[model samples]
Every structure is written in structure tokens, then in C-alpha cells.
Target: MINIKRLTTSDADFGARLDALLAFESAQDASVEQTVAAILADVKTRGDAALIEYTRRFDGLRATSMAELELSQNELQAALAGLPADQRQALEAAAERVRSYHERQTLESWQYVDDGADACGTLLGQKVTPLDRVGLYVPGGKASYPSSVLMNAIPARVAGVAELIMVVPTPAGEHNPLVLAAAALAGVDRVFTIGGAQAVAALAYGTQTVPQVDKIVGPGNAYVAAAKRRVFGVVGIDMVAGPSEILVICDGHTEPDWVAMDLFSQAEHDELAQSILICPDAVYIERVAASLEKLLPTMPRQQVIRAALENRGALIEVRDLDEACRIANRIAPEHLELSLADADAWVAKIRHAGAIFIGRYTSESLGDYCAGPNHVLPTSGSARFSSPLGVYDFQKRTSLIRVSPAGSRILGRIAATLAHGEGLPAHARSAEYRVDG
Candidate 1:
């Protein structure tokens, strides 16, 4: 039988226990950090030569030149064409759905004239523009995910990014066709068979062949995470995410089996992944536990699921659904599921969560693949302030200010007063110069 924590809201130590479960050491190991810093410096100095050497040493791909390490558009399209009919259809369908959803999120430039007295006719607004180029790092080999390709690349495309350069490490010169196919479907402009800190460095500081990108997005291992963290200001990056997480708030009306599998969906991601269930019904919690035991043997990734559950999974009995919502806000989980009979009613109660999956039929898996929302969500309680990756992530907003002569004269006195109060003589003089005599 699997051993998972059981908590009750009435217990005096419940808050402490919950805090312990939520705490995770997100700090990178010193050795990993040191190694990443060295690799980043080497790549910055040597450019393509460093990339080639790292590729040979780490990926065991003996490429003579940067050209040899890159994949052509023809190859990407060929990958798409070669997929089995079902896989091709699924990829295309998912891409279209994702594209449609993100199209609505595209930010547009807008301006309006100021109407205040003496400040009238001054134009102020925002100009929204997409990044010129973005680099996407897709994990290759066993962790290769075609879904990630769609989730990251499509938003950049929808935001009108000029170029999307993708880097996936093809260890031993092996490429995952699904990833390439997804790239092609999502309109990625370039692909390089590279990985690890070197790939991130190449993207951050362009090599002979790889053009420098404005931002780097996607997932990778500890080395990749460390590289992104090291080069943050040099280039923008999507969040260095924590492990996958799911918090299911069931109300005893959903099937216990359904609840158990929902928990497994996130737990199967990795050993550090967390799966929790909060319900008002104590007996129903036991039913879900039994369901977990019964279903564990049938999963292909049983070891990972078991480890994640035994390590971080929880079944908590709350005083009521209201208490569950309060706890959910505190957790701010990456994925929140309302598995209640009246799931829609409880949506307003949830103020935090990267994504909210409503109703029993809306499994977290759907949102991962075909549900049309970007699966790249804020993890490790970041949902409290952050949000899911979208077209907005790939767009930049610039404040637009155009002051009329009348408005500048009126605003100049206000600026001069504040600037002089801060003890900046130049700023005061500059503003006073624009003021009327």
C-alpha cells in the first residue's frame, strides 16, 4: 500500500505539516552552478567553437561545423509529413486550437488624448510590439515533448515574432520526429541539434551561425535552468519552473477513481511532482486512497508515480468547501481542479492557480494537450503573482507619451518642483527650461 500524508483542519499541527509539505529547496547545487558559470564563460568567449566542442563532448555528436549541427526547413517539414496519420492529425489539431486561443491574447497598440485641464491634447498610451527573435530549448531524448513545442512556439508566432530558433539536443545524432513535426506545425524558423548550457549560451550570445535571440523559452534539466538563471539580464527567459503540481478540490460527488487518476496525472511527471486532494467528506477521501492503491499497478510509469505520491501527495479533510478554497489560495498550485458537482459555482472562490480545470470530465491531461490553453504554467506557488505563458509573454509594451506645447508648459512646473525636491539641479533646470516665462 502507498503511504501518503493525511491531514485534518481541526488538528493543531495541521498548519505546520502543510507548510512542511509545501517547502522545497529550489536553490541550485553549488557544483551545478559552478559548472554552468564555466560553461557560459567558455561559450561566450569561443562562440561556435565552444558549442561544437560541447556537443561532441556531451551529446557524442561529432559535427565538423555549425552548419552540420543545424536542421533545414525541409527536414522539419519532412518530419511532419512522415508522422502516422493519427499523430499528424493530432499535432495539427492541437496547433490550430492553441493558435486560435492565443490569437485573442495578442496585445495591440492603443493611445488616447489627455482631457485634463491645461494638459488637454497630450497623447498617452502604449505601443505593443513582439520580440524580434526568440530561442526555444526543447529537451530531447527521453524527455522530448511535442506538446511543449506547440505550447512555447505557437505563442511567439501568434505574437508576430520574426524568427523562432529552436535547440534540441540530439544525443548520438538521434532526433524525435514528433518534436520536429510540432516545430514545423508551429512555424519555427530554425532548429539546431544542441542542448545543455552551451545551447542556452549560443542563443543568449549568438555564435557564427546562430543569431542572437531577444528571449529564450522552454524547459530543460538543471544545467539548462542554471544557464538561464546566470544569463537572465543578457536575454529574457521563461520561468525556471519547479516540478509539476496538481491540487484537486473534490466535494465527494466526483467519482473516487476519477479523483485518483487526476492526482496521478501530475505525480507521474516526476518524483518531485506534488498531488493533493482536499475534500469535506472524510469517507470519500478514503475511497480515493483505495482507488490510488488499486490503480497504481496498471500505470506504465508506476515507479515515478509511486515515488511522487509517497513523497509529496496528500489527502486533507477540510471543515467545508469554503475552507478548501482558502487553503487552495494559500497553496497557489500550478493546476487547480474543481471536481465538485457544482464546479462552476466555486470558480469565483479560487483567486490563485495557474490554471483551473472545472468539472469531473475536464481532466488535467486535456489542458496538457488539446484543451487549447498553454500548458506552460507558473509552478511552485508562483501562480500567486505570475501567470500562464501566452502571446503576451512574447510581446513588449512601450509607454507612449506626446506632450503638447500647452501641456508641457503646465506639466513643466509640476516636474520642476518634484525634481528640485530630490536635489537634482539638472532635472530641475531641464524642466524649468520648458516652462513659460
Candidate 2:
């Protein structure tokens, strides 16, 4: 049974409990660390030979050579042709929305001045160049999420990425048609039949077959995440994501059934996924709980949802909406749904959250698929500092400084002084040489 707490009687104590409940501590078991390290070391030492072995062991498939893993253009086209018209149309439409949103996020170079006639300036800008190559790891464990392909690949494409490579595992050495169709719709340059830690290793430190990528993106299971974390120094990664989390703030005006269903959306993702409700009214909580009982039986993924809620979900009655907003900011959830009366008014109070879903009509699922924002978000309380995967992730920025002779002379003394104060004569000498000469 899900626990319910009232904030009125023990305001401070209950608030602290809420904070403890929401905090995402590193709960990784020791075995995961050992396993990940072993896998990474194996890949580093054996290279392609190790990857082939791991692929067979984990994914139950064999790739004797790297060439067998790569997907051909005709194969991708056949996958798209095989999809029903409705599914194909939906994928294309979602890809367009994703493209449009990320296009707006593109940044350009700029130049700025520091002083007057003795002019010192810096080219203060970011070069929105795309990654030469990227790998998108789509999960093939319990189910297939074609939407993950679009969400991960389209941003890279809009950012002008040269090559988009996708890797997914197949149980019977056969890729799902839906996954292939999504790859086709999102303009993935290449597709590969590989997964788990070995796939991440192959992408980070290229094998004889899989090309080395500048960065890797998309969500995966624990082994996949651990592999990404282990290989982070070799290449860039979006985030070391945790399980899915949804924090919904609701009022008495909304229907109970809608609230329960909204919570269930994230809960079904995994057994550790969290679904929280922070509201002021007790009557609304009761109604939502009853509705959850009614709806849980109808869901095909009921077992997953039930375990998630029982383990990590909560319903807390706060003093008022102001307190609710404060708690929400502190939690910094991956997905925040404002199912309140004046959702817009509360937007200003949100200092943290990977993505905000405004109003009753807007669902978190929309953002996961057809919505204009990228779905690759920071999870496990990382919303406090990190951000969603975007066009900027594919690009790197380099700072340029241009100083005239006069500017150099004017700035050299300060540089020398600071360098000398820090007890570094070489640093001082380098600046002194420019002014002296």
C-alpha cells in the first residue's frame, strides 16, 4: 500500500520526510561496479574479439564480423515499407516536431569588446557544429521504443551532425520492424544489431566494425548506464540517467481517474520508477487512490506499475500550493506535470525540473513522442544542475581572444602581478615578454 502523510500536524517533520523520500541516493550494488569494470577492461584489451563474445553472451546473437552488424539502406527502406500507414505517419510527424524545436535552439558566434582605444575583445560564441558520429542505444529488453530513436537522432540531425548511428539488440538475430521504421523516419545514417555494455564499448572505442563516436545518447538499462559511466573519459555522454520519475502537482478541480493514469504512465517504465503527488487537499487524495485501484487492473503492465508505486511512490498533503511548489523545486524531478487550476502562475516558481508539462491537457507522454522538446532528460535528482539532451550537446565551443599591442601592454601588468602573487615566475615572464618586446 502507498503511504500518505499529512503536513498540518507535523509540518517540519513531514517536510523532512518528503525530502528524504524524494532524494535519489546512489544505491548501486557492489556487483554492478565489478561487472561494469570487468566488461570495460575486457573491451579495452580484446577489442572486436571481446565485443563479439559479449554480444553472444548477453544478447543471444552472434556477429562473426563487424560487417554483419551494420544495417544496409535497402534494409531500412524495407522496414519502413513494412510499417502500416498510420504508424509511419505518426513517426514522421513526431520527427518533424522534434526537428523544428531543436532548430530554434541553434546558436551562432559573437564578438565582444573589453576596453576603449586599447581594445581587447573575445569572440564570445558557441559553434553549433554537429558531432562527426554519434551512437543511439535503443532498449530492446521488455519492449521497443521507436520514439527513443527519433528523440535521440533528430536533435543531432537538426544540429548538423554528419553521421547518426543507432545500435539495438535482437533476441532472435532479427531487428523489430518498428525500430527500423523509426530509424528510417529519423534519418539515421547507419544501424547496427548490438547492445549492452559491449555496444557502448564499441561506440566509445571503435572496433574493427563499429565506428568511434564523438558522443553517445539515449536511455538504457543499468548495465548500459554503467558501461556509459565507465567509458565517459574516452568519449562524451549525455547523462548517467536513472529510472523514470514523475512528480505531479494537482488540485481538487481535476478528475481522480486522470491523475491516477498520469502517475501510472511513468510508474510502468520500471520497478524503481517513482510517481509522486503533492497536493493540499485530503479529499482529492482519497479520490485519486480509489481511482488508482480501479485503473491498475486494466493496465497490461500492471505488475511493473504496482511494484514501482509500492516501492517509490508517495502522496503528501502540504500546507498549501506555495509549499507544494517549494517541495517540487527541491525534488527536481525528471518530469513535472502541473495539473493545477492556474498552472501558468506556478511556472515562475519552478527552479528545477528536466521538463515542465503545463495545464491539464498536456501529458508527459506528449513530450516523450510528438511534443517539440527533446525527451532525453536528466534523471535521479540531476535536474538541479544538468539539463536535457539538446542541439548544444552535439557541439563544442572554443573561445578566441584578440588584443592589440596597446591592449596587450595594458593587460600584461595585471597578468604578471597575479602570476607573481601565485608564485609562478614562468607565467609572469610569458606576459612580461609580450609587453617588454
Candidate 3:
């Protein structure tokens, strides 16, 4: 008896209805933005004192000093050792897979002579380098995702980030061993038990104890998102992601139960998360809906799943798989699953999507955990312009240019013309100097 929306391509208003379903606004409250601005200003001025005070006021941790909140290397190692053998092995295995996959994405510096473009042997290329340091924020409390630790930290490490600092909230001074273990395995250089806007400020501005990071990455609540938005130019950010999304295109060949569970996987994320199904078979869509109603009650997060499905979920009856692909291209979902038997054939049809899961057996959840790809993806139609978090996110590029003496004669004249056209006398003069020398 879920109240999910049902639609068909034959409907005249199908396009408009679909747009309404996919629309999302990530804007924050004015009050939240103002509060974040104050907190950032306070942290920028007071440094460690502001961090300590906020940690006490917000997290209820009345620590005497900042050192007390910092986790030592020994503590991280002990957390890894304390886990059950099976859990430790699984964590290690996932880390290895993630690390191995990101190794291939590591960019290297390269240069080449522009002999074709210029006869004077002018050199032009690019230099790739990783950020010197990066800060990672993990949401704490009842939810603890060690997977996020590996997803965010492993890429920074693989990109050769010199120091990786992690901040997680420890309300009442309680910590998650699994989180610490993942941090240890991912080679995080530091750990602090602080969160919210204050943690972001500490990483962004640096305190007496916490070192400044070149870029900050990870997920958090509204305040964290607000803080990252406020400090964007000061530091690099991964993305202010929206709700989790999954668009499944089934060919009516996949099992009904499997399709139902696939929708649940994303709906379970939260109430605003979206789960949509596009199929040519109207009866198969009904079968999946029935399966959803029947299997939903068994889930521990049943109420959350129900809310998400009833509010944002949809089942669209398309003319065929080609129509399904066209609709999916419009959605530009964060996670896309091609549940067709010949999933690979349709891959070329998909041009947008943060990550693509091929085949019925390849559930989006696999990409979330041990799938060897970074689970952090662009959300809320951002896949149209952005991409999944990878080693490239933590790395930067610099353009390389060198002009030979012979090259300056021709290059200088071209530069001088452009500079004069732009009305910049100094630029033209500088290029003229190179030509004369």
C-alpha cells in the first residue's frame, strides 16, 4: 500500500511531472548560514580556544585541553587490533581493493616540446601534483560508516596527500572502533574528536594543535555543508552533495524481488532520497511494487524506507528500453543500474550519471562498499557537470610553459598583439622585452 507515483510516456504531461520529481534544492536556512559565519569568524580569531569551547557546548565534551581530543597513533593501531578477525579482514580487503583501483587514477606530470605549433622549440605541458594536506569529516552519532573513511581517505593517500587529518564527532566522548580502524588502514595522519562547523573551521584555518589542510573533503550535516560553502575559496571541497539517488532501468527480465530491493537500497538512505524504476513492462512494474510492499516491513529501517518511497519514488512505464535510456539521460541520477540482460549494450546510451552499475547482479550497494570504486558520487543532477570523487579530486594541475630565445621573436609579437588588443601596456612591454633579449 505504498503511495509511489506511477506514470507512462503516453501521458501528455509526463515530461513536466518527471521534472517535478527530479527537482531538488540544496539551499540552507539563513539562520544556519549566519551561525556558520559567526563560528568561522570565532574559530579564525580564537583558534584552539574556540574549538575547545564549541566542542564542549555542542558535543558535551568538556575537555581540559585540545590534546585530550586528539587520537594518537597508538590508539588508532589498538582500534584496528581490537576488531574481530573477520571484521578486520573485511575492512583490510575493502581498503586494498579501493587503493588498487585508485592507483590507476593517479596522474603523473608530463611535458612536450611545441615543435609543431612553434618552430622555436617552445615547450608546453602540464605538471600534476597532489595537495600537501587534506581534511576529512565523518558524521558520527548512532550512524558510523567505516566505508566512508576508506572512500575519502584512500584516494587522498593514493594521490600522495602528505598529511590526512580526520575529524569525527564523539558526543559524550564515545568513539567507533571501526572508524578508527578504517582511518588507521587508510594512513590518516591525524584524528580529532570534533565535528559540525567548528571542525570544518579548524581544518580550514588551523589551530594551535591542528595543522591547516590544503583541501577539505567528506560528508556532514547542514551546518557542515554551510561551513564548506562559506569557506570554498579558502580551500577546495569535494561537493555539497544532495540526497542519494538511484535510477534503475529494467528490461522486465530481472527478478521482481531483486528490483524491489534495488530501489530500497537508495530509499533507505533518508526520506528525501529518490528511487525510480523505468521499464517497458507495466505488469512487471506492478510486480515490483507488490514486492516492495511485502518486503518493506521486514527491513529494520522500514519507516524511513516507506517515507522515501512514498514521497519521492516512481515507476515509469516506457515504450521500450530506448525510451528508458532517454528518460534516464534527463534524470542524470547519481547512481544508475542497468538491470537488462544485455546491460553493456546500453552503456553507450548513458552519457550522464556519477556511477553506472551494469547487469542485474551488480547492485548499487556493491559500489557503496567493496566494489573497488569510490562510492562518493555527484548527486541531485550534478552528474551533468561533475564526477565521482577520485584521486584526481585530491590532486591539482599546473600549466608548464617555457619559451626559447628563437621562439620569443614570434611568440612575443603574438602576445604583444593580444595584450595591446586587451589594453594592457605592461603585458605588451614584458613580451617585447623577451623579444629584444
Candidate 4:
């Protein structure tokens, strides 16, 4: 059963328990670092040979060359055909929504600057260029997440990434058809049958077969997360995602069953997944707890939900809506579902969250699919700083600056003065040259 706590108590010591419930900080031990470093070193030295060896050891499959890992067009088509019509339609629809939403996030090159003289206007702008290649990592251990494939690849495609590669682990030497079909829908360029720390290494430091990518994005298990952290300096990453988390802010007016289901939606992800509820009414907490108990047995993933709820789930009673809002902001949850009657009224109060589901009808699952928002979000407490994955993740911005004679003269004195103040004489001299020329 989910732990239920009353908020009416005046005890200050309750803060400690609340902090413990909110804590999702990664436990970085030396072993994780050592293991990841060994994997990286192996890939760096042996290249394709190391990837093959690691694949055999971890993924329980044998593939000597990168050619064996690459999926053929026929294989992708076959996968799509194998899916039921309804499932296929869902994937296609979700892909369209994901692509449409991300297309809006695309940026274009722009310039803005003017000086008095005809040839003196400075050209100050930013160039938005897509990465030459990108890699998407999809976990395949617990279950296949086709949604993840669409969420990661659609945004990259929309951003005009030239080469979009996807990697997933399959022990049976078979790829999940649903995953391949989703990849097809999202226009993924290549699909590889590889996973774990070694796969990340192959992507970061290209092998004979797998091309090195400018950026790597997607969610994975602990080993995969550790690998991303190790390769951070070598290549860009979306985020070192932690466990899944969802927070629900509900009023007594909302149905307890609806709130419970929303909580279960996240809790079913893994035992480390956190599902939290904050409400002013103690009666709501009791009702939601009862609903969870009633619904747990009916769920196919009941064991997972049970373990997750036992480990990281909580139901907190707050003094009022304002306190509930403050608590939600402090936690900075990945998926925040505002189920209050007047959800829009409290939207301004939420300072941090990866994605906000604004009404009772808008559940977190909608955002995970056709809600037109990127499902790949900053997990754990990263919502406090990082943002959801989008087109920006697949593009790099470069500043463009052109100084004309008159423009340089107008700006040079201040630049020289600032450079000189910082003890950079060469910088000051360079600016002075432009002004005097």
C-alpha cells in the first residue's frame, strides 16, 4: 500500500521525511565509474572487435561485423506489416504528432545589427545547424518502448539531422517489430542490434561499421546511464536520466481512481520510479490509497507497480493549495499532472517541471503519446535545471559577428577597455586594429 501522511501536524521534523521522499539523487560509487571506464577503453582500443565481444557477453548474441547488426529495409517493412492495424495506426498517429510538435521548435539563421555608415553595419546573428549524425539508445530488457523510438527520432528528423541511428539490445537475435515499425514511422536512417555500455562507446567513438555521432540521446538502464556520463566530453548527451518520476496535484473534486491510475502509470516503469500525490484534503489521500489497493490486482504489471509504490511512492497532505504548489515546485517532477478544478489558476505557481499536464482530462499518458509534447523529459530532480528533449538537442547554434569600419569604431573602444581591464592585451590590440583600420 502507498504510504499516506497527514499534513495538519505542526512538527518541523516532518521536513526530513519529506526530503527523503523527494530525494532521487544518483548514487555515484567508484564501481560504476570503473566499469564504464573499462568499457570505454575497450571500445577505443579495439573498435568493432570490442563492440562485438561486448554484445556477445551482455546481449547474448553473436555478430562479427557491423553489417550483421544493421537492419535491412525489407526487415523494417516486414516488422511494420506484422503489427496489428490498430497498433500500426497508433504509431503512425503518434509519429505525426511528435514530428509536427518538434517541427515548430526548429530554428533558423538570423542577423540583426545596424551602424550609421553604409558599410559599417555589423552582422550579428546565430546560425542553427543540425548535427551531421546522431544516435538514439533504446532499452530492451524489461520491455520494448516503441514510443521512446518515436520521441527521440522524430525530433532529430524534424531538426534536419542527416544521419539518425538507433541502437537496441535483443538477446534472441531478433528485433521487436513494434520498435522497428516505430523507427520506420519516425524516419530513422539506421537500426542496429546493439545495446549497453559498449553500444554507447561505439556511437561515441565510431567503429568500422557504426558511424560516430555528434550527439547521443534516449533513456537506458544504470549501465547505459553510466556509459553516457563517461562519454559526455567525447559527444553530447540529452541528459543522464535517473528513475522515472510523476507528480499529481489533485483537488478533492477529482476522482480517486483517476488519480491512482495516473500514479500507477509512472510507478509501473520500475521499482525506482517515484509516484507522488500532493493535495490539501486528507480525505482525498485516503480515497486514492484505497483506489490504488483496488486497482493494483487488476493491473498486469501489478508486481512492478507494487514494488515501485512500496519503494518510492508517497501521498502527502498539504495545508492548502499554495503549500501543495510549493511542494511540487521543490520536487521538480518530470511529469506533473495538475488535476485541480482550476488548473490554469495554479499554472503560474509551478516554477519547475519537465512537462505539465494541465487538466483532469489531460493525463501524463497523453503527453507520452499524442499530446504534442516531447515524451523524453528530464527525470529525477533534473527538471529543476534541464529541459525536455526537442529539436534543439539535435541542432547546434553558432554566433556570427562581422564588424565593419564604422561599426568597429563604434564598439571597439568598449571592447578594448573591457579586454584591457581583464589583462588581455592581445585582445585589446586586435579590437584597436579593427577600429583604426
Candidate 1: regions farther than 4 A off: none
lDDT of 2 by residue, 1-437 (tens): 44433344246577577766666666776898788888878887788888778878877776787677778988999999988999888888988999899999876666576655544652233344567899899987556889888888888888788998888887668678888988888899888788888888888988777789989998777888888988898899888888899999987678888889999999998888899888889888888988988889999999999998887888878778888888888889999999988799999999999999999888899999999898889887889999898888887766657776777777888899999999999999999998897
| Cα lDDT computed for each candidate against the true fold | 0.95, 0.83, 0.93, 0.86
Q: Indicate the worst ten consecutive residues by lDDT in candidate 3.
A: 113-122
Better of 1 and 2 by TM-score: 1
* Candidate 1 structure quality by residue, lDDT tens digits, 1-437: 99999999999999999999999889889999999999999999999999999999999998989999999999999999999999999999999999999999999999999887778589999999999999999999888899999999999999999999999999999899999999999999999999999999999999988999999999999999999999999999999999999999999988899999999999999999999999999999999999999999999999999999989999999999999999999999999999988799999999999999999889999999988999999998999999999999999999999987788888888999999999998998987887864
Candidates sorted by lDDT, descending order? 1, 3, 4, 2
TM-score for each candidate, following the candidate numbering: 0.99, 0.94, 0.98, 0.95
User: So what's the TM-score on candidate 4?
Assistant: 0.95
Q: Compared with the true structure, what per-residue lDDT tens digits does model 3 show for residues 1-437?
A: 89999989999999999988887766689999999999999999999999999999998998979998999999999999999999999999999999999999999999998886565898888999999999999988766889999999999999999999999999988899999999999999899999999999999999999888989999998899999988898998999988899999999989999989999999998999999999999989999999999999899998999999988899999999999999998899999999998899999999999999999999999999998999999998889899899999999999999988999988999999999999999999999998888
Per-candidate alpha-carbon RMSD to the true structure: 0.9, 2.0, 1.0, 2.0
Error of 1 at 38 (Å): 0.6
lDDT string, candidate 4, 60-99, tens digits: 7777777887897788888998999999988889888888
Name the runs in model 4 displaced over 4 angstroms: 1-10, 116-120
| Number of backbone-clashing residue pairs for each candidate, in the order shown | 0, 0, 0, 0
TM-score of 2: 0.94
Better of 1 and 3 by lDDT: 1
Error of 1 at 255 (Å): 1.8
